[model samples]
Structures are given as structure tokens and as C-alpha cells.
Target: MQSMSTLVFDADDTLWENNILFIRVVDDFLAWLAHPTLDHAAIRAVLNDVERANAKTHGYGSRVFLRNLADCFERLNERPATEAERREIERLAAALVFDQVELMPEVAATLADLGARHELALLTKGDDAEQRRKLAASGLAAHFGSVHVVREKDLAAYLALTSELRLDPATTWMIGNSPKSDIIPARQAGWNAVFIPHPHTWELEHAALDPADTGVLQLPSFTALRGHF
Candidate 1:
């Protein structure tokens, strides 16, 4: 709808390889724990447990996940890690926030084109500093008129954006990777939503809904979004 004036995007998986990087690092750490002295299955179980526990307590994002991983490593090893191992783990953990982050193919081009015609905003949830840094470093900061980095993705946050922007939900669309965090909530808030699945979405992020469930639209990629609006 050309008349729709505001477009809000979810920043993490929607635009880049975020959760996948953390999963990769966790897989690497699990491999390291397969040493003769460690129980591989037990270690993996503990890591999964820690992740579930932390998800409830700390919420999502690379920074919080890394901290939980570090604590789990120390507890499982029953001793402080060697300097080399510590450095390695820390490096892997930090990679989610920094390292090599490239925009998904066509994301920049799509956003640039959309920015010219609509009021583009980023509504993301993460460690405030890390999310801001990623947006800035990815060269996406200039395209968005406003960026909201919140601690959690909830009804309140969605409502706040509409209120702050003086936008009617009927004319604002939310584009994101998570059905739970983006699609359902946007629909509930009376806004349209577009779901573009990322390859490495976490289980927590999965929420099933029929295409006819609401006004939420599901697309395979950002490049396909132009035709939807």
C-alpha cells in the first residue's frame, strides 16, 4: 500500500546473520568440551539448559548469551580455564556481536529503495550498545529515520512506536524474522507484518500461524518484499 507511510523492521536476523553466529560458536565450544576429560552429551545438555534458563532471565542477544556461556564453561570445567582456552572461548563468544557481519544479500538495496518512499524505522531488541553498534557498522544507520533498541519485543514496545511516530497501525507495517516477536504482535496491535525467515532462527523464535491467521504476510526473503506493499 503506497499510502502506508511507516515501515518498521526487526534488526537482528531480518537483516543479518545474528543467531546463526552464536549457534556456530556454541557448536565449536561443544566440540572443545569433547576432550577425554569431558562428557560430550552431558556438556551439551548443560549448555542447552543454561541457554533455556538464561533466555528466561537475560532475554536474547549475543552479549547475554556469551555471558551465560562463559559462566557455564567455568562451572562445567570445575576450574578456571587456561589462558588460551579462555581467550578462545571469549573470542568465539564475541564473534556474534562483532567479527564479520555482512548484510544479507539485497537487504541494503531493498531498504534503500524503500527508504525513498516510506518512513523507515528499526525496531530491534538486544543489548542496547551492541545493537546500535551493529546497525552503525553495517552501514544501515543512515537509511532508518528512527531506531528503537529495546530490552524485549512486546506489545508495549510496538504500541510505543506507533504512538511516538503518530502513525496509524493500519498504515504501518512491521517486517521481521520472528513470528512470535513480530508477526503475531503486530497483528494484535492492528498493524500489518511481513515475515522473512532467516536460516538459523532459534526455537524460541518460532511461532506457527496460518497465512490467513491475520494481516501478516510471509515472504522468503527481503527482495520479495517490494511486491507485497
Candidate 2:
């Protein structure tokens, strides 16, 4: 690690507890459904399929996700969802999103320590306004010199960001929990990456990195960065 380098961070599970909130809502939804024939795993498969398919068209956010759950309910129940059911789903989705922005252990202090010497930036992908709202509520927004909330974190997006920021790929490092979105793509974009694994990361964000990419450094947790940077 070099002194005063640009450090790009993923906003969700890396910096704070994010996926767990959605998981809690999904648990509640499954319990409420109470399908007599389907086991929890079976039910989840259907819902996961629905979410995967809908993601392309609807994008991600509480509003889009709640609507996808409603569609999943209809797909499983064989009957149209009632107004009450829709409202209940919305109520559950509302509980997360902007309400809970709990930072991961030692994240605030670690970021504070790193921010003093490094150029901190935030790069997260989701619904733009919703992601910003969460960042605003988190109270860590001020630490970042710039923030980017994109629809997706693909190779092109990473390259575009590097160009836009006028960053040197050799000195810029991306730190995050998602290998698929945050690690692999950032590495492919020619930036060094620090991967801090999260146990309960969202299933869709999991990927095995190619052994050939030697630019990535793996750390056990967020606070460990203080030792390296």
C-alpha cells in the first residue's frame, strides 16, 4: 500500500450490515407464506428465481424488491395477491433500506484513521436515490471525497470511474465484500483490490476469483486495513 492513495469502498456489507436486513425480511415473508407443500429451501428457490429475473427489468431498491415479492407470492399461491398482502410486504421492506445503517465493527474508527492519510471514495451499485439515502443516514458520507451509486458494478463502470476521477490504477485500491461485483471487476479494471470477506454476503454477489489475478490482497476484516494502509 502507498501513502495518500485513492481507496474506493463498497457501501453495503463491507462498511455496514446490509444483506442481513433483507434476509430478515425474506425470513418473515417465508414464514407468513406457510406453504403446505414447499419446504423453506424450495420456497426460497422460487423467490430467488423471481428476484434474479426481475432484477434486469426493475433494478434494485425497496420498492422494486417489494413488488418482486408480491409477484412471487402470486406465482406460488395461484391466486392474485390481495391489497392487504401488498401493504404488508411494503411494511416489511420499509423496515430496512434507510432505517438501519449500522456500521460494521470498528468501521467508523478505522475509516477515520484511514481517511486522515488516504483519499477515500465510495463506489456502490443500486438504485441511486436509495443508496444515497442510506449513505446520508449512515453519517459516514462526509469521509468520502466523492460518491458513486451506479446501476451495476461491471467492468465498464469501473473503467469509467477511473477515467472520470483521473485516478492512477496503480495507486487506486478497491475494498469490498462482494467478489463478483466489487473485487473481480475492480481488479479487471486494473486497480488493486482489498477483499474483506463477509460470511452472510448476498448469494448473488459470490464469485471465485481467478488465481491469475495477483493484484488482490485479502484481509480478514475492515479494521485490518489500518495496518496495511
Candidate 3:
């Protein structure tokens, strides 16, 4: 029924407004700190170090990220933060986790159309609970055949998913906004990758495509995705 054998989609940013919401919440949290001299960039750099270290073991999600932030705040300030300050920071982080899922433009229509004719799967990297919660809230769960949420998006994880799906890598397509997490790994696993670039993608997720390889495709918008099928 479909031109492609299967389609694997990344949950955040590709299907909905995820990272940008996190960015906004981080900005709010930073403002609440009221540090006049430390700009957002410097503050984020400190936070990034903490997150990267924590992510290796705790994985990605709001809970782990919030904890890392708390740790970073204390380390940067050279003293433990007050309970009230921690609470304020947590409140901001809570908004990101509990907020209603906001679909990108044409996501609903596009998914509905694609679902009718193809096998669709959702793959994301985050804490199991938070990722599942977001997927449930997304209202797009019905469209997917299965979902996989991992602590990391590496070659092993991708291989495991494809093995479970009984998919031929050459015929499967991985679609997402992050080059590091979605595109490169999929391509490395011998799967076709379609990149739907998002402006607010996280710095850690950034990666440049190789010049010689041309199999990877890029779509300007979600609405344009149907044309490929």
C-alpha cells in the first residue's frame, strides 16, 4: 500500500513542538535566577556540561535535566541554592513535562495520510516515563504500529529496533529533525534518512551531513512529506 516498506519517525521537534518549549522554559528559569552579569549563553554552557555528564547514566528527560540544572546552579554559584530557588526552577521545568503536546503544522494531516498506507513507528531518546507521557498526550499514538524510547540513540539501539520490526534497513526510512540522533545513525545503519530541519534543535543534536553521500533527503516542511510517499 505504500511506496516505502516502513517509516521510522523521531518524536520530538519532528512531530511536535518539543525542544523549543524546553528552550522557553530554560529561559524562564534563567530569568528567575536574576543573575545580572551571567548572560544566557554562559549560563547555558554551564548547564550543558552538567547535562552531558548526567545524560550518560540518567539519560534524557525533564527530570534528569532538572536535576542537572540544580547541580549546575550550585556549582556555578559556589554555594547551595535555597529551597525556594530550587522550587522555582523546578516549577519552570514542570511546565515543560506536563504541558499539552503541540503538533507542528500539518503533522496531524500528514500522519493520518501516511498511516493509511504505510507501517509507521516512533523512536525517541528520553526517560521512559516522560517519553510515554508525551506520546499519550500527543493524540498521534493511533497512527504508529509501535514505539521505542531509549536512553540513547546510537547504532545499537537502531539495530535493535530494526531487528524487532523485521525491517530491511535499505527500505526503511528514518525521519526527524536532529542530525546527530536521527539522520546520521539511521544512515549508518543502512537506512534511508529524511531530515526535517528545525530551527530550535538542541546544540548537542547538531551534525553535518557528508558531502559525498546523497541518499539522505530533506523536506522543508511536514506538509511536503506526503509528496515523497
Each candidate's clash count: 1, 0, 0
State the lDDT of candidate 3 residue by residue for 10-121, as single tens digits: 9999988888877888788778776768888888888888888888878888888789879878977889889997887788787775447888998878998988777899
Instruction: Evaluate all candidate structures by whole-model CA lDDT and list the values in order.
Output: 0.81, 0.90, 0.86
Pairs that collide in candidate 3 are none
lDDT of 1 by residue, 25-97 (tens): 8788888666566576777677777877887789767767876777788788778778887787878776564
Q: Which regions in candidate 1 have their CA more than 4 angstroms from the true location?
A: 35-45, 74-88, 97-100
RMSD of 3: 1.7
CA displacement after TM-score superposition, residue 193 of candidate 2 (Å): 0.8
User: What are the RMSD figures for all models against the true structure?
Assistant: 2.7, 1.4, 1.7
- For each candidate, what TM-score against the reference? 0.86, 0.95, 0.94
Write one digit per residue (lDDT tens) for candidate 2, span 1-229. Answer: 5578999999999988888888999999999889999989999999889888887888777777897789889999998889898888887777775855889998889999999999999999888988998898888998999999988899999999999999999999999999999999998899999999998898888899876778998999999999999
Model 3 off-target regions past 4 Å? none
- For residue 206, give model 3's deviation from the true position in Å: 0.8
Best by lDDT: 2
